[model samples]
Target: MPGPAARDAQASGSPLIDTHGRVHRDLRISLTDRCSLRCTYCMPEQGNEWLARTSILGLDEIERVARVAAASGITTFRLTGGEPLLRTDIVEVVRRLAAVSGPDGPVQIAMTTNGIRLREVLPQLIDAGLSRLNISLDTLRRDRFRDLTRRDRLDEVLDGIAAARDCGLRPLKINAVAMRGVNDDEIVDLVEFAIAHDAQMRFIEQMPLDAGHTWDRSRMVTRDEILAALSARFTLTPVPGRGGAPAEKWALEGGPHTVGVIASVTAPFCGDCDRLRLTADGQLRNCLFSTTEYDLLPILRAGEGDDAIDAMLRSCVHGKLPGHAINDPAFLQPARGMNAIGG
Candidate 1:
């Protein structure tokens, strides 16, 4: 039997839990691999897994993982999925995660959803301790939305966004992927929608990490492009994410709210990459674009114990490269998409 890695043991009062000096302040755990729709950027339109019905992390597993993650340093956690709402007992999972208070401090509970089923479950989720929402909505045009997601029910998503606002997930965030020549035209529209809703919007640059890598850099919508487009009509002032973050943020000129830009391709933000992903099956991934991951469940489930799990995660984070070189021509996206990887 393989002995547990030395980094797994958490000393009595050691505030640091992982190798990256990361206190584990934030965690994004995937709930399922099945999604109702496959956005081009996230997965293929057809010939993909639909009945990918795996036994999602049981509620007890989620709770246990949260406890382990918190003990190591993660103070905030977000639940994601092929579409998290597709899970059978997501509300219960949120309830459990929300109940966690890390040694670093209280954990901030959040979720990243597609917004299709949000309307039906918004109230339940908010009541379960969901504090913030990051809804993926690339285009505002009804036709374009249907074309992009291959689903005609744009109204459902729109309604879901409204319901989330009504439920008071204050300052809801709208995340948009800036695809060249496709939804790029809707940047201004998305901005206006956020301003109208008093929500914070994020325009993310499509990365090479997608199956949609056949993109044209000529049409690549850089953060500068978006700022310029919005600046023509509204002045944008800078408001960086969390801690002088990479997502270049700006408030619209004369607009009531601000927007954020995620440029992972044209510009890679790997150095300050404080993000890590935990897949539905219990693999902790240090970088979304990296091919490496440390399997915690197999060992822990095999009875290696909590200290072992903690040390394993520490070695994983320590082995984590400064930042992934995803934009390089040599870069090839992992066979798995965002959904499979726990977007």
Candidate 2:
């Protein structure tokens, strides 16, 4: 009884078109809940309790689920983690995901990494079909980097960024979480750094995802503040057609570079959000701020076919909330931190 469009939609396995018609085409998969750096905003300065090895999904499992998602209209996959590169089989992971295709053709593959170990894996990752990269660089000062991330590997990260550029990773990006009274003073410096390297810089407002539960809105820098700082030094022109993207981007007037701001706290983009997250342990998070997650490991390991997995995937997206509810007074921080949830 379905019409041609309905049949085509069903046949395509597009999960984004829920009953509410919110279509999510981007999927973020966390390879592991382990990390090399101790970023104060993401994790406690002391350390984190890592997920058990047995709990995490294998690379093959991740690939299988991703294949189904891609067939269902998921065109973008971004590998995240406490640090995804820390996984031993990361190259294979990329290789398998690179082969997945949707109605639109080959899926776009990208990653968000701390850039510590990128020096060793950048070449192989590029060869394995990684087309995009977003490296986290918080501070330009060596001492500040060490103090913030609790690691003395600033030089290594810089080298990784250079290597990523040299490897022909088109549109390499730098993500810096700007906080008031912390690294806010380095906005221009970070912008200059991105421009110098032919990379795009995105300043994200600090969110409430730290393991230490120390995110204070008072200390968080808003996008307006970031733009004000940038405007004082440079002329910025808005780039239209953000679509479901989290960052509102801009072009520096009279330059070939671009800058962006992900104002998750001050500016919410949940209405046009087109993302679904899968944690390292095979749990599906409908939203980054989702309080609950659906476990997929049991069903996956139970030898269920693609049909069953597809049903669960549909149910999860069907129940996805309209928004992340960050502005509501009732908004409670997610039980898991950003690193655990695949930031």
- By lDDT, the best candidate is 2
- Best candidate according to TM-score: 2
Query: For candidate 2, lDDT tens digit of each residue in 1-343?
Result: 9788655555447555765678879999999888888888988866468899999999889998998898888999999998999999999999999999988999999999989889899889988999899999999999999989988989989998888877878798999999887799999999999988889999999999988788899999899999999999999999999999899999998557899999998899888888999999999988899888888998899998887777777768877888878889999999888889997
For all predicted structures, in order, the TM-scores are 0.90, 0.96
In model 1, what are the clashing residue pairs, if there are any?
7-311, 8-310, 8-311, 23-73, 24-73, 24-74, 25-75, 234-253, 235-253
Write one digit per residue (lDDT tens) for candidate 1, span 10-92. Answer: 45224433454444456789888777777876777877754334435578877887887786667778889888998889899
lDDT of 2 at 147: 87
Off by over 4 Å in 2: 1-12
The TM-score, computed over Cα atoms with residue i paired to residue i, of candidate 1 is 0.90
In order, candidate lDDTs are 0.75, 0.89
